[model samples]
Target: MSDTLSPKAAKLHNRTLITTYLYEHKEATKQVLERELGISLPTITQNLRNLEAEHIIELGELQDSTGGRKAQSYRFAAKHRVAIGVALRSNSVCLCAVDLYGDTVQERTHAMSYTNTPMYYQRVGTLINEFAATVAKGGSTVLGVAFSVQGIVSADGTSITFGTLMHNTGLTLETISQSVHYPCIMIHDSDASAMAELWFDPTIRDAVCVYLERRPGGAVIVNGKLYQGPNQCNGAIEHMVLVPNGRQCYCGQRGCMDTYCSLETLPEEGESVPGFFSVLEQGEPHHRERMHTWMEFIAQTIVNARSVIAGDVVIGGEAAQYLDDSDIAALKSRVQQLTPFSTDTFSLHKSRCADTNSIVGAALRYIEAYVDSICTDAE
Candidate 1:
């Protein structure tokens, strides 16, 4: 027999290659796919037709051909599937629906406290059902659900190893998954935010994402992936001791970074992050001094972290949106001073997703898995 792939195997391989290419490139013409995939025109046309029939790919605008006939471009129909992301906080739940393209098409906040009671889980399930109904369009399917919680999540996303906010430990995936019909996963809030940053900016292959929200925390990205330590506590930056005998952290640690760098440190009179930043922007001597001191502590933390992890530092969360370029520059300068080895400027970046990073990242988990599953099956 001739050495060739069986008809069925070849078709599946072509479909997988074409879909993966379009997913990465966003859109491509038949000719482009043929050339990039090293597949013949007939095979490309056949696979494209099959994918289009399955509502996976769709024809786009005609591309300008150098010669006679124009070519038709094809793109992945990203909105064909959706994923739900629920950020379970201490007193509120942020539910968001994201499409395959990582767009948050629908979102809403429901007021509820996190608890271990069955009633609470049932309430969350009801809210999820209602929200899914509201957000899912006629042709789109809910692929899965991801939960971003303020706690230490298991490596497999099946349970919460520890949670300080809920004062609970060993919270299993069944608690939330039983309420929703779709497959579910649980992730630490900081890790989700880090994933959001990585998804929004492809250039950031490795970095430490610092979240300065109501409760400060961090996530470490290694080789373009979240690095949960062997114990699943890799990015607990909040508990890092910044001062030898400073303010007390909720974790019962003295002089932790959370006590110094969190949003809680902002003056209460401002009422909100924007208002607090506004006060600092007004050029008041004391307010400016306070901000300067805060930046110093933040810089100190970055220097300390860099010495261990050696990657770019990304500042994110509610407070990140209020920080201007000058503020980042100031923080960078402080870091440069504190660091002894390199005179070069440290690689620092601001978060692109702002307040919605965790929720968006949560949704992306399922979207990413869906795509990976296709590739895996092809293999």
Candidate 2:
């Protein structure tokens, strides 16, 4: 968007824009890209050719012959340029890899021991490399690694200043970035997920989105861009105390929203948020009662944030996987009970991404960085 941007950088930027478009549209012909990107025919063809050479995308079979000629459609070679994304959770680590699109080509998860300054970084470091190596398709180049830990990332992504679960945040960035043999980037899970939402769901563009995830984060998206606060912690809502003198939080706060409603707070062991919701659906009164109380508490916090942020709220997380569309609609009804906003503006629901949502989110962060670097070099 800047004239000062170099030609190469601009091309990379356009490539990114186009890739995002193709990721959204799945398959597009040259004419489709020309219209969608507003680029000349030669430029579109050349970029497509270059991308194809890089194995970023490939031409599909021809569509119906139009008024002129049957044009070949291009689809992402999601297996071509791979990137790994991982979320650092208190109880476990979630890993995923995707293409330019937020489509998870591969994913894996495992329990991680508590984070020590060094051991945690080493463990996460090992996991990232292993995941990338194990699942990547043939001859694909892993562009970079992205992580969406549940804390505030430094402006330069050099360190994470806050994370009870991510104890190695400060050291891990440097170590991982140095040792990964790829471009390493990090972002708060809240904003990372927001980026994933933007790429994965274009209907969210020019729209404000509120994401409620189990990792304890929030984000404000305007016109397809994430609104990170000046401190790069705009969505740092894990510390927001929803109830005074209600419960103790790991962050040394009383009654933080996470303390009350996070899926991690479920009292029973061996119960995931989704699993609990399943039991509730089976007419288990115990799960139903606890879930109702949790939903009410979450609804209250969202009502306040909704009034302040004022957008369509998207309820997503590992908890959302088990919830059907009807369940989300019902949850929306529950949130409306507390909010004065008209039902028309409220769109509360579960993210369909399941556990891979954050993983795809992490991949996008690296993809953006990859595009930026290419564009910068192009210029």
Candidate 3:
């Protein structure tokens, strides 16, 4: 490699860099961009003009003068573009539209069965198009859509390789994309939830997000990026055999972690996880004992996973939000005692996104892809 950029390539690189920088910082003065990007004043000005003309960025305010003329500040026009995230569940599809700043602009939940027929997919497509039109009313461009499915997703994010909750296997992206007429990608729901945790909490660069939803699963993050193993099952912790011959699992396995750690294990007294926790919080001895046992199982799984992966464990999904700080601390203590390694501290975190983490994360995937495309074009 020559280790140098051609004039044309350099210009593209600088433009992408400036745009990305503004996106991260929200707003910055031209002087700050020039200093940080190490580009000349004229080059920065030209790039800013180009970005502004494209409606990607706009002048915000004047920077405070330092014994000289004040410089103009710029910010990304985040509302100018939007991305859609669809969370496909067994009984409903939850849609969310997120702006460039990762804020949810609109959300809607549509009730539907996870059918393996074209008619069902077409209906989903129509709903997505109608939602997009609603979002576009404000003159925002619909960049793309990402679907979150609770299953094993293809490495390319184009299909559902396998799913225990969904009736369809090998479901192509076109099943939904054909109706919406937009770029689309499919993501494992667990992976999407983990991405949401990483997005909200930057401190968690490397961690295992244990998703304790209706269908239990997990996602592995290493070096600030998702690490999909050779078979794209790197974080399929739910399949880990907890007992040799215990409760049966949907994956045709006996005593799988999912059988013990999933929401299905909870009592039917409450309709939702939060409602169940409310009963526990009221000093209900039966539910308390049940929760204790559940926490113990989760602790064991975390210890076993940490022995191999060696990172913080974040409990995510609908149930995580209901777990108080004391509950998490107790779980951490249990994991510490179970682990063989000598560790002074254990990093356990609760998910910030309540029930919509996966939805936001799905949208973030497309937004990140958009940014990556800009950088790739520069390259």
Candidate 4:
């Protein structure tokens, strides 16, 4: 077997290395890239030229030189391609366009009840096409559209296997893709939120995202990657039983963690998550007690989950903004009391991308795919 890569393979590898570096650093000179990436100056120049031709990279103003000639700076054109993310809720839809750097270029939320009819899906697709056209006004390519739904998505990303919140189970991507021009896929909201968390903090290797929205959900990250498991249901923590023969869950289970830890139950009828937390913070005795009881259930759930997968935990979603240091401390104390292992092994924190995480994460799928295609010569 040959020890060295073929010329074509070497070219692809060098281009991947150079592009990856520029994607991270945002800007670099040919000389700087050659030195830092340890590639030949000729190879760097050729790759940069190719990228410029494709509009993936652009030439910038000359750098101020300390000596003779000023080196020309090359900038990664992040907005050359844009990914569309659609977050489908029970009564509204959140749409956002994201660039290569995972920054939102445009975002909007529209009030519309979800119905599993072809007309409804076609309307959603029409809205996405309009959004894509607006994003494309600046000459950016519309990469694809990703739908973040509240359910378990199949590994193929074509259909929702388990959706109850919006009654969208069995919905196929083709239904929406028919009216839209771009490629499309469906993603579970919890997994989508986890992707956003990963983008916000790339250093996280192993962790669990405890999504405390209207319905409790979770995502598991192992070895710095989302673990969908064989059934694509590895992180379905909502159905984890907490109390036997207790309140029934939407999944037809009794005392599942969702029945107890859901933020939906924390707020009173017609009260918002913020309103409930505000009253709790105002020294309301009953509200405070209610929060305490909720925290106990949340801590119990965390400890139970940690017993199987000993990773750091992040509490996120709609209610994440309301959690304070005191709440975290209380949860930690309770977790310590319940945990069989030392709580010091795993740390806990609140979510940084609370509300926008799912939308951003959904769009990231396309962004990541575009990068991989370029790096692997798939394009």
**Best of the candidates, TM-score:** 4
Q: Write the per-residue lDDT of candidate 2 for residues 1-379, one digit (tens) a residue.
A: 6357778767777777677677657789998998977877887888889888877678888999858788899987766667888776777888877765456777788897656555666777777777777765466678888877777777777887776655554644875555465677887787777787777676774333334455466777776688886778675566678888878887887988878778766536877766766677788877778877877877776776776676677767656665577767777787787776554465565554555666687788766666455434343
| Model 1 misplacement above 4 A | 1-6, 62-71, 343-345, 375-379
Q: Which candidate is the best by lDDT?
A: 4
Model 4 C-alpha lDDT per residue in residues 1-379, reported as the tens digit of each score = 1128777777788888888888889999998998898888988899999999999999987999989899999988999999999987778878999999899999888888888888887888888888889889988899999888888888888888887767778888887577988888878888989998888888888888898877989999998888889778977888999989988999887999999988877778899878888898888998888888888888988888887788999999777788888788778778888887652577789987847889899999999888777656432
Quote model 3's TM-score.
0.90
TM for candidate 1 is 0.91
TM-score of model 2 vs. true structure: 0.77
Tell me how candidate 3 scores on lDDT: 0.84
For model 1 the local lDDT of residue 174 reads 90
TM-score of each: 0.91, 0.77, 0.90, 0.93
* Better candidate by lDDT, 3 or 4: 4
User: After aligning candidate 2 to the native by TM-score, how far in Å is the CA of 145 from where it should be?
Assistant: 0.5
User: Could you tell which candidate, 2 or 3, scores higher by lDDT?
Assistant: 3
Cα lDDT tens digits for candidate 3, 1-379: 1129787777788888888899889899988998898888998999999999998899899988888999889998888888999987778989999887678999999989778788888889999999999999987899988898877888776777886567667888877577877888888888888787777777777788898877788989998888887667889999999888999888898999999999878876545676777788899988888998998899989987887888888888767777889998899988988988774465897877758888889899877777677545445
Best-first order by TM-score? 4, 1, 3, 2
Residue 225 shift from truth in candidate 2, angstroms: 1.4
